[model samples]
Target: MTMDGALARIIRSAADRAAAAEPEVCDLCAAPVAEEHPHLYDTGAAEVRCVCRPCSVLFAEDGAGEGRHLLVPRRRLRLPPVDTAVLGVPVGLVFFVPRSDGTVTAQGPSPAGAMRWEVDASAWQRLTATFPQLASMAPEVEALLVNTARGPRAHWIVPIDDCFRMVALVRREWRGLSGGGRVWPAVERFFAELTERP
Candidate 1:
């Protein structure tokens, strides 16, 4: 083949490779999964895993692998506004993760990611007591996602992955210093879509 033809062939091959989507495999079982798949929160690793149905079902009710892996729930809840002064989260968007020790960690999304913030243990307990729904959240795998970025603040009991998605959104949209104006609307849209999800 001529030199020009060889270059064209190489370029075409590269394009073909780029167009081929990589198969998403289950982290637990290594099975190929669909675009939208169940995810599990590996407590042992403190990370999330994209998994197939069967592998996720193993921890559906939680407490599988000696409580090492917990299935992330799909439950979504829109909670009424409540007093959160106790938690003292500095940011407008926060996600609270429950611990096995009966304490909840107050965290907020930033350009960095989901960041843990300090809260009074007694006050957190009181807040949870005031809201039984908060107390009942599935430990480790679910989070109370609170959004106060815009007026008429909203609160939702969201999946842990949803919280991570919000973290990712903020990380992606954030600009230098004051987190550019675009970030808030994007944050709003994120919650709006979550609200619309069935």
Candidate 2:
């Protein structure tokens, strides 16, 4: 092939690679966003969206844009140990997701998927009264993540997306009926890193 044709082919290949490797852009304004950038939760449809800094700012407040766009906060608070027994569930890793209707749902990871466990209302009331922080959790966008795989007291108040991410990780790494060995270590590492987040 001619030198010009060969050079053009090389340029095209390089461009293709660059395009393929492009970073994820904000869904709102199409601005380039980093891997660790902010995210938005569409409450109306229960969807998570990647967003840039400015778009996040625009919808930082609750009920922004007719209550459709809710900015996901970056708060990662280490909470005191909670009693899983009181919640009517076995001692294990679980997360509490609050709905807008003033009800909270308890869910945990399993080989099949996220499994819901029945919770006692009186027990939930007692726990929430003990921790006032639980009362302030963002509705539909934040969750109380309790990691008891190691032991009790490994609780955190994290973004709602983190809950889904944890569910995904467990479902992905889980193996056979026993859950194999890798799942526990990954869970430990995840909580460790989560605790260390700024």
TM-score to true structure, per model: 0.84, 0.80
Q: In candidate 2, what are the lDDT values of residues 1-198, reduced to their tens digit?
A: 999999999999889979899778999999999888898888787778999888888987655777788888888888777665777777478888777777778889887768886567677778889888888888778888988767334889899889878888999999888889889888888887785344
Candidate 2: deviation at residue 97, Å? 1.5
Look at candidate 2 and give me any clashing residue pairs: 81-153
Off by over 4 Å in 1: 1-19, 196-198
> What lDDT tens digits, residue by residue, belong to model 1 across residues 59-128?
7663466787778888888888867866877777888888877677878878887789656778877887
Model 1 gets an lDDT of: 0.81
- Candidate lDDT scores, in order, read 0.81, 0.81
Q: Which ten residues in a row have the lowest lDDT in candidate 1?
A: 189-198
TM-score of 2: 0.80
Which whole-number lDDT from 0 to 100 does residue 104 have in model 2?
75
lDDT of 2 at 181: 86
